[model samples]
Target chain A: MKKIFLILTISLVFVFLSGFNEVVASATSNFSISIVSETPVETTVIFRGKAQSRSYVTLLKDAQIVAVTQADPNANFEISLTGLSAGIYSFGLWADDTAGRRTSTYFFNISITEGVTTIISGIFLSPTIAIDQAEVRQGDILNILGQSAPSAQVSVFINSGEEIVKTTGADNDGAWLYKFDTTSVDLGDYSTRVRASKESEISDFSPTASFKVSKKSVKSKKKCPAKGDLNNDCKVNLFDFSIAAYWWKKSLPKKIKKRVDRKLYRDGKINLRDFSVMAYYWTG
Target chain B: MRISDLKFKLVFSFLFCILFFVFFSGNILAAHLYFKVPENLVGVGQIIPVNVFLDTGGEDINALEIGVDYSRDLLKLKDWSDGNSVVNLWMERPGSDADKLIFSGLIPGGYNGKRGLLVTLNFETLKEGRAGVSLLDSSEMLLSDGAGTPAKLSINDFWFYVKEGASKLESDKKKDSDSPEDFKPEIDRDDSVFDGKYFLIFATQDKDSGVDYYEVKEGEGGFERAESPYLIRNQRKKQEIEVRAVDKDGNERASLISFVPVYPFWNGGIIIAVIMILLLISSGVYIFKKKN
Candidate 1:
């Protein structure tokens, strides 16, 4: 009778233990997955969460793996996404532990708001002017070198004129040079300014650079100024003689002919003879 | 002694039966099916993704059928996908007939887990209103206990509001000329025995018009649309990776990793040479045998 009681007790304990094992084996733990992200995500999004440590985390969109990462020691994971088109996207976060003992799959419903297209105003810097020859002869080629925004179209204007005298594109180095012929321009002082433009954006004109176009200067001839009017006064007097005396014995070049005549006149040399003529015409 | 022993046996059996029922029955009742609808503030014409899930609790669920109802006038079903679902065999692929989404699938050996993703449904807001999403009572979940007993499921419905005045959507239409700022990406190579993959991560800001997207290409392949913290699938030998950051205004900036050698032995040139030598030897043997 004692043996029977003991046997039955052992059997019951075995049955209970086996039942407990079954329950434990089939028991499932709580797995919660949450995504913290701003709704109406535009071009990029970040989804972060905590999961089983060393788990394989996969982010899916339209049934394709868009991004993937692994959880760290603290069971924290983060995924960043960029360049998404404006539309609704069905995304899923699936995590499988390294031991393959557990899996948690969660789906998220998100809407990608249409991104706003924006127009950007570009910065336009003024160009610089560097002339190779500041003073050039007429009909000569003037090399105008300058720097502006890289790859910008530089318009070189002459004499501050509205018309663009020359147009050239700046190289990748932002350096440009224009060969302008001075033949069309009048013989006088001229100034040039340049502006750089790219697409629709135009920069301010550069500082003006002044240059001279040198041509032979012509002198006007006057009638032989009445004997001793060396001072160019209508009446010859002591003042004319004083002016003549100041230039006495001075040799004049062929281009400069004096009007006063005395003995040995027409000679290139200005002597006492020219002074005596001025004295003779003295009315004072 | 005999009478007392008989009484004790009977009591013990009764207690065992009660304990078994108490523990097992609770497991059977824990299975549930529901929709996870995030409270979303959307604009008219905006598309949104919604997910349906099955919480097995502790039960092994083999098959299930779900029916979702939504407002037809306020929303339009755009598309749906069953990829990455726990069900291996699908009895019915998720589809939308007007405003309702119907789905059913079978999982062999049943799925024993806390949660399983069923399907992802995409819907576009048609107008400004509150769109209510709920699971119909006709939805059924079958247990994997071989008898195909129906599992009890609790349904939770949620609402999403589609408003008319979304200022952000209104402001996105202008042209933005500011190029995305220059950025340097961090590249990490994995040579560990378990994972042999490369990870690239970087972040940049576009003050004007916001950043639109990023693109990455390895070797000579065409640029693939990608994002920061992206993974490179190639684990072979040396290759170049180029990444471009593009803003909404079509302005772009790029960064490149010239050469990254993940595996030293996986050389294309050596592989081709070996293949050529094998072909030559095989052809020579075939010709020699024919002559003999």
Candidate 2:
């Protein structure tokens, strides 16, 4: 009886040990695959997941193997695919342990678009260009103002010329201003437009703004005539007397009196004294 | 013997649990970048707007390169815009050659959000057919974590159908008939310096179709394209100014204001001469009285 009891205890111990080893082996052999990419992939996609260490990862599209890679030290695996055509694609990811003790297969459906790869949408509008003045004198400053895409670089083309005269960047509010010196521009009508660019995109040219550059007007500075040249025609005649008679008794402002001869009229009135002075040097 | 066996089993069970946990919990979600276009039937000759955006999935990205492929025969690249992009600097300006569009830019501090637009592309349909826009594999997004690590991105392409004789075009034409609301313009005058010139400032707003341009006329001068704050030639004379605000659809609203400029009494040359003569006469009379 003592010997039989001893044998039964040993048998129970051996069975328990074998059961624990089986449980461990089964547990370590378990692996799984999870796709980390968003659905409806265009031309490229990335698959990432976890698998047993030193495991082989195979990616199959429509039952054909496309890629094979190995999991990292931490049992993390990733697969990337590119240049896929447009159609319904069935992707299957299978992870096989190095010892061939475990394997996992994950299936997913991806629909690729035909023809175009990406469709981008947003607010897009043609820019507008406005000038400060429609006409400017030679040697004056011409200010170009306009609105375009925010944070975009704007180039101003003068006379729609091949050369870009000025370049400026638009502010956050999409407003931009550029000042061009008209001293170098010839005296004639010229058209100017602007276009905005950012990254690889260039916007359409803005509407042209036409402006004229006129020749600078010259003012002749000549001394006040001997007396009656009120019109500054370089002659003291009846015409000058008529101008003096028109203001016979009126009170004149200081600015106007300064322009007139102070010698004839020291006081602030136009009377016979001024007329007499005008008559003295009259040349009608 | 039993104690040793129990100890070995405990250690083995712990190791198995650790391996299971590591293998099952190692997945990290990545960001997504894709295109968005109208899915409805677009009409031939219609302008279609497409948007490229980034769904960061809570990652901060600083730089990106996007390449798009399309059918050039069915669609003509009209224009593109970066109006709503978060990137401030362009490493490569967005452009298209034939059927491919490419763009590259960088955001200063990085962007972390959902559905951030990168660019907008406008295309005109050339014929009735289906066209696909897809992302090329060369596209890349760099994380903002100083290492410039490439972010894992899953891209999605889009397909659009163009049809002949679509009703959307008729609706767009009908919208043009709705005239822009009439708005009164405010007038301002600038006469600080007496250079014998002043400016008449007029400003108004058009809610619909935006103000195309402005036309202004002084007196009998023909209506000319003039911006607000028009320069008047004569400061001391009355100016009959008429301003019209024209909308994009060619509808116009006009406003007229008469400006009568007044100069100070000191500005008159004739008035100053008269005052001087009167003063001289009074002085002469006083002198004659004293002499008598």
Candidate 3:
């Protein structure tokens, strides 16, 4: 009986000591993982230190392993996951040693989306976008309107055989119009495509529109000015010289011609050639 | 009154209403100035010719005035408003004439208070990277009909970005000038190891404030804080200074080591030759000493 009690006591004490050691070992062996998202895009998580032993890592989303990688003991390791959607997501990590001993769990939150929140919904379809003009001269404002869903994002795509213009968001109720400074666009037929997307989705392309442009610049022949063609009278004789002399002395009848001569010839020489053109015109 | 007279009056009134509807509806359905060229991403030193278009409801406007508000540190102004179309030639800083701008213009022949006109501005870049160009407030004014007093119009301003790089036009021309066979993309591996190359650091939470000076580390080929804050550069392509935080005591924190690989021109042939020479000299000396 005495031997039995002594043996039982020793066994109980030994078991308690072993249990305490095991608890300590398990606490030290455990590890926790977490994820942190600092930007709009969910970046891949990176690990800096090496695992203590050869192990395999498993990335878990809601306790489900979405990705896995093997790592060497005492060797640096890294694995990347394409970030989550445009909302908060919890992620955890666990590493299993060769013997299948697992690590403690970790967690982190991520938000992946642009900060600009746009409200969309009200959209009115129009029969056709009314351009301010059916035909416009170069540098003329090509006003456009028809009907738009109020507060929609409207942009005009000017098809000048190339992308000639792009625009910012327009106020539909106030200024939902796009202007084409025809100076940038060559004289030709153009089909301007208006696109209004509701939620920044690429699939949204507005119905196309077409318009014609007329060149305002006078399509005149490039003629050289003869010296005595005072009124550009087309002759180099005394008559031309008389006109030039008059303009040179004081002022001429046509303001544009006077200004041109004053600009081109400041000294007002008014030589024989001017007189010859003026004389020829005067005679005719 | 006779029936014929009453009928005639009704007909006239109906025609008047129809005409009124046509004119009023036309007036309401007008277009206005929406935006400009270089919607975004303009290059530094590159001339950006912006064409301004107006959306006047079949009317004309005369005389438009434009203004600018920008940072001289980042952008430089050249010339503007050539009297035809509004033109602003901008250059980026650190090179020459780099600056930001606000542009506006006027048109003739429309209701002065509501009509819009287009102004085309050509800008030149001064540097590389991103910056903002906006239309300043109270920068646009329109004239009234009969060319009288001009009324202040509500101008919708815009912000566009600029990215200055080697001129694409020049680059394309260069490509045409140089045959493809003459163009070599190989990296030269014969340069010195330490070619007096320095580092550039950038830290900006937002693009508006721009980047200030970078924190640096000390050494020949190690990290360092940038001497000039505010003027930051992206050094991802080169050997850059790894930044570490400083405490109140001016001591560095035990930070993670950063490693970047850079292969500059030079160092290849010299490294191999130096190794070969050392080996040969060592062997010759060994043979001589043994024989003695």
TM-score of each: 0.28, 0.28, 0.21
Error of 1 at A61 (Å): 22
Model 2 C-alpha lDDT per residue in residues B60-158, reported as the tens digit of each score: 676677888877778887766554355433434466554467776655335666777677677888998887778888887877543446788877777
lDDT (10s digit) by residue, model 1, range A158-225: 87344447799877655678988878777777788787777666655554566777764222222222
Question: Interface RMSD (C-alpha) of each candidate?
Answer: 50.2, 37.1, 37.9
DockQ of model 3 vs. true complex: 0.01
TM-score of 2: 0.28
Reference-based TM-score, model 3: 0.21
Candidate 3 stretches with Cα past 4 Å from truth are: A1-284, B1-35, B81-118, B127-130, B147-152, B164-292
Model 3, residue A7: C-alpha shift (Å): 92
Candidate 1 per-residue lDDT, tens place, B123-206, comes to 888998889878888887776543446677877777878888753232222465656545566565422211435666554445
Clashes (N, CA, C under 3 Å) per candidate: 10, 38, 74
lDDT of 2 at A260: 47
Q: What's model 2's lDDT at A8?
A: 55
- Reference-based lDDT, residue B230, model 3: 13
Q: Which of the predicted structures, 1 or 2, would earn the higher DockQ when compared with the native?
A: 2
lDDT of 3: 0.38
